[model samples]
Structures are given as structure tokens and as C-alpha cells.
Target chain A: MKITNTLLQMVKTVSITAITVLSFSAHAADDKVYRLKLAETWGPNTPILGDATKNMAKIANEMSNGRLQIRVDSANKHKAPLGIFDMVKSGQYDLGHSSSYYWKGKVPNTLYFSSMPFGMVTTEQYAWFYHGGGMELMQEVYAPHNLLSFPGGNSDIQMGGWFKKEINSIEDLQGLKMRIPGFAGEVLARVGAKPTNIAPGELYTSLERGTIDALEWVGPAFDLRMGFQKIAPYYYTAWHEPGSETQFLVNKRTWEKLPKDLQVILETSFRVAAFDMYTQALDANATSWSKMKAEYPDIKVRDFPPAVLAEMRKATDELLQEQASKDPQAQKIIESQAEYLKKSRAWTAISTKAYLDTQ
Target chain B: MKITNTLLQMVKTVSITAITVLSFSAHAADDKVYRLKLAETWGPNTPILGDATKNMAKIANEMSNGRLQIRVDSANKHKAPLGIFDMVKSGQYDLGHSSSYYWKGKVPNTLYFSSMPFGMVTTEQYAWFYHGGGMELMQEVYAPHNLLSFPGGNSDIQMGGWFKKEINSIEDLQGLKMRIPGFAGEVLARVGAKPTNIAPGELYTSLERGTIDALEWVGPAFDLRMGFQKIAPYYYTAWHEPGSETQFLVNKRTWEKLPKDLQVILETSFRVAAFDMYTQALDANATSWSKMKAEYPDIKVRDFPPAVLAEMRKATDELLQEQASKDPQAQKIIESQAEYLKKSRAWTAISTKAYLDTQ
Candidate 1:
């Protein structure tokens, strides 16, 4: 009876064309629910990285007033932690939450979107992405793949790693067995370090039982849980993947089907969620590092000596140059990043760097 | 006839109670539009700061599907640039965009929400606000005044100032007639510098004609337009207002009146807009500094000598101690910030600082 009466009132107001047009357009959209399924690379209940997807989904749902409902499927459910890009592109999922660099095997240009060894820091990279033609370049990369990409979240600066002993000079890194993966491993290999990839579950035991002398996991916020500091007392500072950014992917068909308002809501959600993750990582790292210091008084925070760092940086440049020479698109991105880094770093040196140094 | 048929169809499907309830609630919300008014301390089109409000309003409108409309009035329309706190409190405006320190005179504790002397940098402060109880302390200060406050935006790091001569020592600062304002000015005065506030319009002339020997304005992004570099050859690095954060002010009553969805939309818009402004500031500063350097190749980037910086830090500590002695609330906030700064900076030193220094 309530439904009937409401519809009857709508019929009575039909003589007012303005009201009728407004009612149909707005009501039709509001009444239909958009239920999207998102597949994430992380397992369910993972910390900061997992939190970003949930935060974004909740914000979008609330802002849309239930018009947009998103179901997040973690890797536990999807059973393909590294398959996010393919799943979203193939429409197996409407959206995916993962880091862009994971797809580098399939798309070499994808490597630039994530953090680079000795690249710009978080804020500098964000400035590049939003204002320095990064977003447009990113779209160009993804558009051909039936996908669209947005920055999902940042994990803040990833520390260089944990070492059982201090690294005093370039000689210390020679033939050092370390569990370091991805592009950074290649850089380490060039620097005479024996870089090896080990599964996350076996990392602690491998380091403890002498299978590996060192391992480079995430920073304190994540590393604390693995008890790496318990066995490895020397915690090195960040160099590789200084400001690693994760990405959100959407199937082009899914995005195109969304109403303009929902599209805006989804995009805004990704941005805020990405930013929030960064702060969360900062806070968590601080809290965790404080706790780690109290429990492990002998823990040494080390920086790779200048000579070793110089070698690593040189290798990173050579690797990037090789990629640039192979592809025009890669060259464009590499040059853009290099030019931007130069300008932004100059300002940062006189601003943030000076302030930190003063006090 | 179409509406009549729809009514008949609804009557036929009346047995489904769940569908009827969902439809009624969704349609009712869709039909209503909420209009809000905002007053900003900035003049119209005031670059990064002004862009925050427009971006926020646009995001909220689109995310809410045009159900929420915000009308923004700049200082010109309101004729009360400094009256945002009062206007929002009295319901003259539903929202406001201004810096928290502006209301320090009216509410002393409000000063802590904005940047502080020798305090946390941008991401550090954000970590404090969202995770380290900053929001709660901020709310406690505003609740009594019938207002709610959120971090509006960050202006990145503010450069110390532009100087006509080098500040070589603590002796160089004595009797220095400089245009620096707010708490920073107080710190300068303690060190025997004559710190005075000048109207923005007359600042370039004041400095050029030696009305003031050195003047601190915003960084290159803003100072370039005033051509400060053309006159002041020495551009000092930051010593004060390291990371200045602006704020979003909402009247408690207006906040309560908003629908749950609109409220979330408004808050999320503030967060995203606030973060975007920080990035925008970084980009603009980088671009502007590049331009300024190109035009004036001799612009010297100076840092206050260590002795001078040490004295300024001492002054800031003493002043803060005085505030804490007078009010327990002030004491609480000051201590919280101090403690958080310690923990966060410890992490930062090993993370961001380490990375920057090594590179």
C-alpha cells in the first residue's frame, strides 16, 4: 500500500514536466545498486596495504549512500596474489588493488609507476604524479590493456634491509647472500652482492640458519612482525624503493559503465585512501620502531657507506638507461622523471633537507 | 499512463517487504538536496589555498550526485577574513577554511593545530593528527565553542624568508628589522631582532626600500609573484612554520543537521582536498623556485648559522613552557606534540632523513 501510494503521487505530479524529468533521472540512478567486486593482492586482514582497499570501499559506499557497494576479495579468496592486473583487465573482477610494478613482467613500462632506486621521495613523487604529467602517462600505458590505473596507496619508504653485521664499505657487500627481490635485486647483483629471492615465510629462518646472511623486507611497521630484528641486529636505512606506491586498477568496461558521479566518487576514494595509507604507515613505523628499540637495545640502525651507495646508484642508472634505450615510451617516462627529480630535489634540498639538517 | 502502470505494478509486488523498504529509503534521500555556505579567509582564486575549497566543493557535489551543494564566499564577499571562527560559530556560515593559528588569540590552544616552531614536518604532523590523538585534542578545544575542526590542507614547508644580507651569526640577528609574524616573530624578538608585521600589498616595497632589511613571506610559489628575489638576494631556508596546516571549520549544529552520507562526503572531501593542496604546494614551489632561479641566477639560498638556530630553538622551548605552565590543556597539547615528535622524528631520522642525507 505504501509503495502504491508513493507511485500514485508520482503519477499525479506527472503534469509538472520539470518534476517528472528530475524524478526519473535521479530516482533511476539512486534506486539501482552498483555492486562491484574488487580483488586485492594482499591476503585478508593484511595491515596497512589491506586497510587501504577496505577504507576506499567504505568511503565510496557511504558517499554514494548505498548506491555503490563494493565487495573486496583478498588473495585468500582469489587464490592469485599476483594476478590482479589480469583479473581486472579480463573482467574477472571489476577492480583490483595491487602495486603497478607487479605487472612489469608483462608490461615493462609498468616498472616506472612504483618507486625507483634512488628516486624522489613520497611527496616529491606525488607532486610528479599529479602535476608533472604522470597521471596522463600512466593512462597511456593502461589504456591499451582495457584497464585504468590510479595510485592505490603508499607503503612509505622501504628500508634497505636487515643485516647480521655492519656494512662498512663497498667490500662488505661483495658476495653477501641477501634475500632481495625485484629490480633492487638486479641492482644488488651488479654491485657484487649475491641476491636471492626467498619466500616470506622462510625469511627469518633462512637468515637465522645461515641460508642467507641478510634480507631486505619492508620497514619496521611490517618487519617487526617477522622478528627479523631478533636475529639480525643491523637495520639498514632506505635506498631502493624509497617511496613505493601501490595501484588500483579498474576494467575499462566497468569504469565506462559507471555514472559520472560514481566515477568521481571512486577516483576520490582511491586518492584519499592512498594518502591515508601513507600517514598510517608513518605512524605505524614510528610506533613499531619505538617498541623495537625498547625490546632490542643493541639494534643498530646503519646506512650503507657512501662507496657502496654510489655503486648501487650507478647500477640503478645503468639498468634504467638500458630500458630507456629499448623503448620510446620508457625513454619519455625516464626523461620526465629525471627532469622533475632535478627541479623538485633542488627545492627540497633548500626546504625540507635544510630544515632537517638545521635542528 | 506510465506512472499509473508503475503504481499498479508496485501494488502487485507489495508482498516483498524488503524491496519496498529499500526503495522508500533510497528514493527519499535522493529527492532531497542540502545546500551549505562556506567562508574562506583567502581572496578569490588565491592559488593553492583557494584551490583547496573549490576542489573540496566540487568533489562533494559530484560524490553526492548533486544532492549536496556548497556556496563558497571568499574574504571579499564576507569582508571578514579573520572572522571565520566567529561566522561559523554563529551560523552565519556552515563551513570555513582558515588556519588554526589565526584563532590563537580567541582560543589559545587552537594554535597547536597549525604548524609550530621546530615541530614535525608534513607527513609527521599528518601522522599525529590522524593516529596520535591530534584530532581528539583539536575537538576538545573546539567543542566548547560549538565548532568542529578538521585538517583543511597543508601549505608544505614554509621557507624561513628572503634576506638582503647574510645572517652569519647570532650577532647578525640583533636589531635586525625584519617582517616576520605570529609566534615566529615572537621568537625573533626574543633574539633581539625587531620583528614587525607588514600588510601583504606593501611588503615588496617595504623590503625593497629598506623599511625592513629582511622579510619572511611564503616560499617561492607565493614569493615569486611579489618579486622578492629581485630585491632580497639571500633566500633563507626554514626555521619556523616548518609545515603549516590550514583547517576546515564546521559549526557543530550545522554538522549535526547534515545527513550521514553528506557528512561523510564533506569530511572525505576535506581530507582529499587537504592532501591535494599539499602536493600542489610541493609542485608549485618546485616550479616557481625553478623559474626564480632562472631569472635571478645569483639568488643565494642561506641557512641561519647554527648558533642563531640554537638560540631560536631555545626561545621556542621557553615560550612553549610558559604556555604549558598557565593552562593544563595547553600543557597536555604541548606534551603530546613533544612526545609524538620524538617518536616520529626518531623514525624519520632513520628513514626520510637518512635517505636524503645519503643521496
Candidate 2:
């Protein structure tokens, strides 16, 4: 009886010790890890997009205390540049950074919000998104496709494009095959220009091989990088896309699965990234332009003729009106934007315009 | 002898067990709780500034995993609004949020960088600071005073002020007490207007009591909030300040003591806050103006007479030249800014201007 009692006590002691060890192990396991894959549209060397993505990933990782890690894969590494949207929406990738204009074929209305022909400036778009409910509207627009959207950055105003021939009037646009996208393409089509959508990687080759006659990428920073000066000498001012906003699209399922704090970290990080990218692009473009002008003097920078711009503006107004008539959501957004613009312009006319005129 | 050997082994075992337990206790003691104190100039009800401070603290706490926390104290909580700089620099608080123009008395050079009478827009200022090394130069200027600076928010453009009397010429400014700050104040003084610095919280009462003839506290947003229309009837447009940038100043010692990751988080968070606040001001101003016009139709909105604006412009040019001659650091920062502006303006003329005219 004594021996049995002693054996029973030993069993109880071992069981308690084992249970404590199991509890410790379970606590450690509760520290969850979420690994995210981010696909970027721009090349690895592009300062604004590349730096923003890298900074965002670093901040997310640090904020999560290493629990959430995002690995960015440049466009060519995972898929072609144009394939980013499909990959993220299909959940083949967790997130994607690309211009929303690139996916106009898949989501037509998305183009207006991304890069409207002469619509909004960087600050104005930021205002519309955050305060005017544009961000919520964008989410609603993208929700059908199983994606969550965030404005990653904005290239304020872009140069028109590099053309092999000078454009003197609306007639010059006939049979002109230009690489453009979104509503701008539709506007160009109205003037008899054939709009060809091509990825940045394929642009140089197409222009060089005569597959395309002209192309519009961004401003001097990106244009200089893509070596557009070599193939096309006449670089026209891109007044259509006043503020071309880039977007970051995350798979809805992946976004929903993230911890609440991680979601906040990601959103805030992207907001900062947008501001950083705008400033960087401005400075980098200035530097690149100086270099181009000094070393590549053969490249000519020109503004679009007034007559061509006048025709394009009329078409843009009609297009916007038509879009508003079709979708009440688009109508509501445009109406509110118009009201805000009217008030802002009144103030700007007296202050900003006055200053510019005097200078 | 065998018993002594066994006892010695048991003592060693007990010693190792005690040491292990004590080591863990020591580590637990080393875990610290750092409480950061923030001072802001806005009242608790101010939407963007007040809300941003609260949000920043919340984000910082969550990002630190609750190890680091921030406690924001609004204006008049512990000190007066204008006392922010001294309080922060003297270590009365770890952080401060206010317009740098408010501290022109101590740092005259800051006014040029913070907000000129008619300087860069919100986007242009962001570009200068982040990419054109304006931030680094600002840090250098503030280093001697034991502060680390970050751009906090922007009150994009400001109306001239609300006044009871009309001034048609430069001579009309003599003996008129106008509420203005920073370098603009100097220009006002040069033109014979009595420049008086008043806090936003005090502007209403001062205006009512006739302590000042005119006052400017941002645009329609904050002016409506303070009910300035009740005290001053004539709301004038085209004030000296076009875009007024606010700043976050941190105690140098406190900033240096922070972890590298926390530093990045703080800097990035402020940048986002600036973008957020600028838009919030825009949206809020629109709402506030409609309410003002409806509720108080007697309130008059008038433009700054061209005669007054012309004089102010001449004074501004003289002020710039004088400062450039006096301070080398100010000269260097201004030169870099001017050079960038020259190129940016040329680009904008061809692109942005062309688009706006056509649209």
C-alpha cells in the first residue's frame, strides 16, 4: 500500500510539470507570423516607386515587431507589368503596386479616379480621397473584383510624350499610334489617334521597331531612365493627366486576414509613402532633365499646339459628362469635386495666380 | 569524505538554480515604460491638428507594442499657446506642434522656410523639404537651439484678414494693428502696418475689444470656428501669407534617446499628418464658409485692394534682398529654393498652365 501511494504521488508531480511545459509552448506559438508578397510595376531602380515600396515594407516589418513581413517582387520577377492587377485580385499575390490606369480594360470606371485627362492635382486628389469620400468610393468600385485599393503616390503633372513627328494640329493625330492608357486614350481616339496600351518594358522596343510611333510614360525622371530621347526627339507636354495617381491594390482576402494593428500600420505607411514619392519625383525629374539637356542636346522638348489642346479639352468635357450620365456614383463624385474646385479656384485665382503673374 | 562531496555538488546545483531565476528577474526589471509628453497649440476640438495628435499617440503606442506611450496636452493645458517653443526647448515637454512662424522672434530664418508672405504651395513646400535638402538645413538651423524639427501640417493659403476699416493704399496701413507673424510681419512693419502677434485662441476676444483692428488665423475653417465674423465684419482676401506651413519640434535630447525604429515611425507619421491636415483644412473650410454666409449674411467678403497688394509685393522683394544680404545660412537655403523654383515654374508654365487654360 505504501509503495502504491508513493507511485501515485510521482505520477501527479510529473503530470503537473508536463502541463506547465505545454502551456509555455502554446504561448510561444500564439505569436503569429504573416508573410506577404508585394508585386511592383516599376523597375527596381525607379526611385519613387522602388524607394516607397522598400520603405513601406521596412516600416511594416518594424511596426509588427517582425510578425508581419512583406517581400516585394519587382514587376518582371513575378509577372509582366500589366499582369499585377489580375495576380493580386486572383490571390496569386498578396499585394500589388501599379498605376490604376493600367487596368482600364478590366475596370473602366477606375480610370477616371486614377488619372483623369486634366482632372485634379496631387493635393486636390488627396483632398478628394481622404475628405470627399473618394477613398470609400474607390473601395466600393474595387470591391466587386475582390481587391482593396490605396493611393500609393502621385506624379503631379506629366510631360505629354515623345513623338517622332511634331504635332501641329488635330489633323496631325490621324493614324498616330501612341502608347497611352485610360480615359486619355479615349480622348486621343476622338482626335483620330490610335491609342496603344503597352507596358513600360515593351515601350522602348516598340518605338524603336516602329510598332508604335510615340509614347507617354511620366516626366523627365522616368523618361530619361527609359531612354526615350534616343528613339523620339520631340517630347510634348502631357497636360491631360494633370495628376496621375498610382495605386496599391491588395487582395481582399489577404487584407481581411491581417491583424487590426497591422492593417493600420500598412495604411499609414502607404500615406507617408505617397508624400515621399511626390517630393522625390519632383527633385529627381529636375536633376535628370538638367543632365539630359546637357548631354543629350539632340532631344527636343516641345509643348502641344494650342489647337490640338483645344480639341482634346472639348472631347474630355463630353466624355466626363457622358460618364456622369451613365453612373450615378461617378456623377456624385464629379459633382462634389466640381463644387470644391469652384471654391478653391476662386481663392487660388487671387493668391496663386496673382503671384505667378507678377513673377 | 563521500558525504562532503555530495553536499558540495548539491550546493552548486542550488546556486545555479538561484542564478537562473535572478537573471530572469533582472531582465524583467530592465524592461522600461517611456512616457512621451506632447504639447500642441490647437484646442481639443480642432479637427485635424487635435485629432492627428491623438491618432499619432495611439499609433506610436501600438507600434511600440505598448512599451512606449505618448500623452498629448492641448493648448492652455499646462502652458499658453505661444509658449510652446520655450516649453519644448527647455524640456518642459518632449514634443510640440505649432507653426514655426510663431517663433520668428527667436529664429528669424525659420519664417522663410515655414511660410513666406507668398511662398511655395503645399506640394512645393513638401518637395523642397523632403528632396531639396530643406529639411536638413532646417535641422541645422535648429540644432543650436536643441530641437529636432519635422514638417507637421499646412494651412495651404490664408486670407489677408478681417478688418473694420478699408485700406486703399500703402499709407493706409500706418498705425493699423494687423495680426500677422514671421517675415510677413517685418514686411508689414516696413509698409507702416503695426504687426501684432496673437494666438488663435485669443484672436476673437482681442478683435472684439478693439485690441487689434485686423486678424488672420488661417482661412475660413478656423476663422469660422473662432467666430471671428461676429467681432470683425469685413473679411479680406489675398492676405500676405499664401501658404502657411506648421511644424513639429522635438527636444533634441529626447529625440536622440529614441530607438532608431521609433525615430523612423515618428518622422513618417508626421509627414502623413501634414498631408492629412492640409486636406482636412480644405474640406472643413468649404463647410464652414457656407455656414458663415447663411447664418451671417451681413458679413462682408472683399478682396485686398490692388493698391495694397502692389505695395506688399514691392516690400516682399525688398525684404528678400535684405535678408539675403544679412544671413548666410538664410541666403544658402533661399538660393537653393529659388533655383528649384525657377525650373519648376518653367515646367509648370508649359504643362499645368496650358492644361488649366484649355480646361
Candidate 3:
């Protein structure tokens, strides 16, 4: 009887000790926190663009129950507005928020991920990215760089530019000094315009001083605050960058280090924030456009004439063809976009376009 | 000395017991799983609509590390496709996936939350919902019902309907029979058309047997499979229910009981899943439309003549005015939507409309 009692007491103590350890280990795993550093191309407090990163960080933290802490460093803090791709790739930053096309000079194929010249609009582009092999293609391009990129947010359709003089014909574009950049600038150059890139702060001064006769900025939401309407009366409609999508970049090493739950939280946060930004952009643009129209009353809304647009389209096609001929990957992406655009546009023509036309 | 030694041993055993109890409680709280039951309006294995709930559950489960478990029951399991509002309100289900308008008879103000005749498109409506006081208005409507409503997904631009003959004038609609439900049906009735509601499974036969002259189903993604293209040669473009947004309903008590982290995960899952459904719908529609066109080259796509459209718009405005006059809440939502639409459409006209026109 004494030996049996001793065995029972020993087993009870061991069971208690084992349960305590198991409970503590599980708590340790659940309670472990992850801190991530993100760098955005936008400056601090930039309206729609900056809001996406902030919103992402906030949601991720809350969703992870304060376990995933993200610190965002905007352009002012990082001092490298255009160097996000390299920063994230080299592990200097764990995450980045910027437009994909900004890295075209370094990785030529990154251009296709953002909006294209005269390409799909916001919904169509999103459909392409999510459902039409766009995400896969984007992954293929980023994998070699040890990074993962996601569609960060859409800026909606960009306005053509703020023009001092009307662009009535291809001849009118000749020798026109305009502050346009990226593939669009290349397209303009091909069509006989003098495409230039100027600092954002210098844009209004340049236009006012005749250093540049015209400039392309974001839509009315972002553009109105710059006081461009006072100097440039003509606000043209979109042709290039129909639906400009910003990107979220993550270093492969940083991503792999994250627990699966945190990874999912981070990605979902990116997606919701991205979609929120697009709606925010649309709402801001609408409200700003209303305010601008009420204040200015003389801001001319013009579409490039059909003939001039045809010439611009031709230039865009030639540039894409040249890129396709040089790289097989480029060819694949270009072809995919072209084919998807053809199919989606037809449906859009029948549905959205048809509805708008009837209205 | 012996009494002090006995007291010390008791203290040691008590400390061990206390530590064990604390650890187990912490583990229990952290590992607790919330299994929510969701009832969807769609039947089992429904495509775009059904995919949303599955995606939401999957993501919520992953992001919460299995803490938030959602069990979705479709119409087949519940046998209450249109009974979601009542079911969720009474706590028979914790969540529901259905369109807001399905509850219009029980709560008339719920009509404004779904698609309106001549309403804003997907992006525009989303902007209104998130930015322009739509969510607040929606909440106000649902607050009295002990439920909360959120935009579940957009079906994109719905087709007007499949017709056996072209609708060229108001006279053509007089005495016409079409299977269209909801607010659009009221608008049609005002214009002297007999609008009928038919069961989904019986729709093909109804149109085929002349029980209905025309029927407005969903877009090509969901329609082509029903073989409507072969029977209805004249497929009219969209005029009614332009962008149909489905809804997610949460029981108030259920929402209040969730821990904040799970709540965020659940809400974010709804958002991302909603957006994903839209893209999936767009891609599916584009692909299906292409296939339908290739197979049925004789299909006629037509827009209602301008005179007929004007008449329909007039009738729609009259009905909305009537509703506004009757209910103060309806008036508020109507005015808000009208004001927002007026401002946003102006921006859209200058941007999206101009781009499409140029193309």
C-alpha cells in the first residue's frame, strides 16, 4: 500500500510538470512578436499613396493582435524615393510601396505590371492581375531578384497632362517640351515631342516659366493642390497609364522568415489597403474635381483628337514591339496583355460602355 | 522548528499549483476557436458567388491561425435562399451571404443598399460606400434589424436581358412580358410592361416556351451555361441593375462577441474576398463572352433606342421620388446617392468615358 501511494504521487507531479511545460511552449509560440520595416516611395502624409502603407501597417498589427508590427519609412526618412526595388531586394528594407514601372530602367519587364499606354482600365487591369495569369507572370519576373511583388493599389485613370496649348494634331506635338517620364516619355519622344523629367517641386515653376510647356501629373485629386490649374488651363484626358497600379515588394528572405499566419496577415493587409486606396483615389478625385470645377470654371477638359491619338497608339505599339523582339519574356507578357485586353475590352464595350452610352 | 518546516513544504506545493493553473488558463484563452456558421443565398457549388464564402473562410482560418473558423451553408443545406435576413436576425445563423435587396419586403429601406436602376457602377458605388457616407447610411438601415450589412461582392455590369426580339421603342415594351425582379421590375411596370419573377431553374423553359418573352439573368459568366444565347438571339445591353453588389450580413450579437483580432481578420477576409470575386467575375465574363460569341455568331447585341431609354429613366426617377416622399430615410439615401453620382459621373465622364470614346 505504501509503494502504490508513492507511485501515484510521483505520476501526479510529473503530469503537472508536463502540462505546465506544454502550456508555456504553446504560449511562447503564440505570443512571439514580429517587427517589419517598410519603405515607401511617397513622402510622409502623401494623401492616397501614403495612406495605403499606413493603413496596411495598422490593419496588419490589429489582425495579428499586436504580434506583427510594421514600421513604414517614407521617402523623407529613406532618402531614396526611386531606390525601393534595390533597397527591398538587398534586405535594407523588408517591404516597399511604389509603382512597378518606376523600376523599368533597372528591370525592363517591370513596366508591364503597372498600367500600360492605352491599356486596360482599373477593373480590367485588376482582373488581368488576379485571374489572367498576371500574378504568375509578375512572380516569374521578381523571383530572380529574390523578391515578391503584389499590386499595391490603383491610382485610377491618370489625366493625359496639363497643357498650356491644345494638342490638336501630331504636328502640334512637334518640339513640344513636356515633363513626361518613363515609358510614356519614350512614347512621346518617338512622336517628335521633347519629353523631359523635372522634379515635382519644380513642375509648376517650369510650366509658369516656359521651361516646360506642359506636364502630366496624377488625376484631379492629386493635381488640384499643386495650383497647376491657375498656370495651365487645359487638363487633358487619359491615354497613357489608364489605370496606374502601385506595388508592394517583399524580400524573399524576410518573407520566408515570417510565420505563416503573419505572412497571410501581411498579404491580406496589402490587398485590402490596396483596394481601399483605389476607392479613396476615386472618391478624392471626384470630390476634388467638383471643387476645382467650382473654383476654376475654365479648366478645359480635352481628349487628344482621334488622328493624333492614332499616332500615339502607333508609337506605343512600335515601342512594345521593339521590347518584344529583344526579349522572349517581354514578348510573352506583351502578348498576354494584348490578348487579355482584346477579350476584356469587347465585354466592356458591350456592358460598361454600352451602359454609359445609353445614359 | 518542525511546524515551520511543514509550512514551507505547503507553500512550495501551492506555488507549483498556482503556476500550473495560470499557464493552463492562458493556453485555453489563446487556443479558443470561434466557429461561425454562415448561410449563403446561392445554391451549393455556385461559381463566382459561392467562391467568395469559401475564399473568405479559408483566408480567415489561415490569417487567424485557425482561431476563426467559418462554416458556410448554401441554399441546398439550409433550404432558405431568400430567408437569410430572417435567419441571421434571429441568430439561426451567425452570418449570411445574400443581396441586401432580398430583404426589401421585410425592410423596405434595404432596397437602397443593393443595385438601383440607373445606379452607379461598381467602382463608383464602392467609392460612395467607403468614402461618401454610404456605409453609415447602410448601418443606420440595418441597426434596427439587429444585423450589420457589408458589400460582399460585385457581379460586375449585369446584362439588360436576353430577348427574342429587339426593343426599339417604348411601344415595343408595352404589353411585353419579361422575367425581371426587384426595383427594375417596378420601373418596367411603370412603362406598361408586364414584369414577372420566375424561378432560376425554370427560366430557360419559360423563355423557350413563350411563357416569358425575355429574361434578365446575370451576365455571360453565369448565363452562357444556361444556354440562353441559343434561344434569345437579341441580347440587349445593360440599362437596369448596372452594377449588382451582393451583401454579407452579420448578427449583431455574434459580431459583438468576437475578440477584436478575430473581428479584424473576419472583416478583412470579407473585403479581400469581395474584391477577388469581382475580378473573378470580370475574367469569367470576358472568357465566357468570347466563347459565346464564337459559337453563336448569329447573336444580335442591341441597345434600347434613346427614346426608350429616356422613358425608362423617367419612370425610374418617378419611382425613386415616390419612395423618397414616403420615407425620410429613403429620402436621405436617395439624395446622398444622387449628389454623389452627379459629382462622380462628371469625373468619370472626363476620364473613363473619354478614354473609351477615344478607343
- Per-candidate iRMSD: 5.0, 11.4, 9.6
What lDDT does each candidate get? 0.90, 0.74, 0.90
Clashing pairs in 3: none
Instruction: Summing lDDT over every window of 10 consecutive residues in candidate 3 chain A, give the lowest-scoring window.
Output: A1-10
What is the DockQ ranking, best to worst?
1, 3, 2
Q: Please provide, for model 3 over A166-223, each residue's C-alpha lDDT reduced to its tens digit, 9 standing for 90 to 100.
A: 9889999999999999999999999999999999999999999999999999999999
Where is model 1 more than 4 Å wrong at Cα? A1-23, B1-26
Q: Candidate 3 residues B246-332, lDDT tens each?
A: 989999999999888888899999999999999999999999999999999998999999999899999999999999999999999
Cα lDDT of model 1 by residue, B224-296, tens digit: 9999988889989997988999999999999998888889999999999999999999999999999999999
TM-score, structure 2 vs. true: 0.83
Better of 2 and 3 by DockQ: 3
Candidate 2 Cα misplacement greater than 4 A, ranges = A1-31, A162-177, A198-214, A225-238, A289-310, A321-354, B1-32, B163-177, B197-214, B225-239, B289-311
lDDT of 1 by residue, A79-118 (tens): 9999999999999999999998889899989989999999
Residue B234, model 3, lDDT: 93
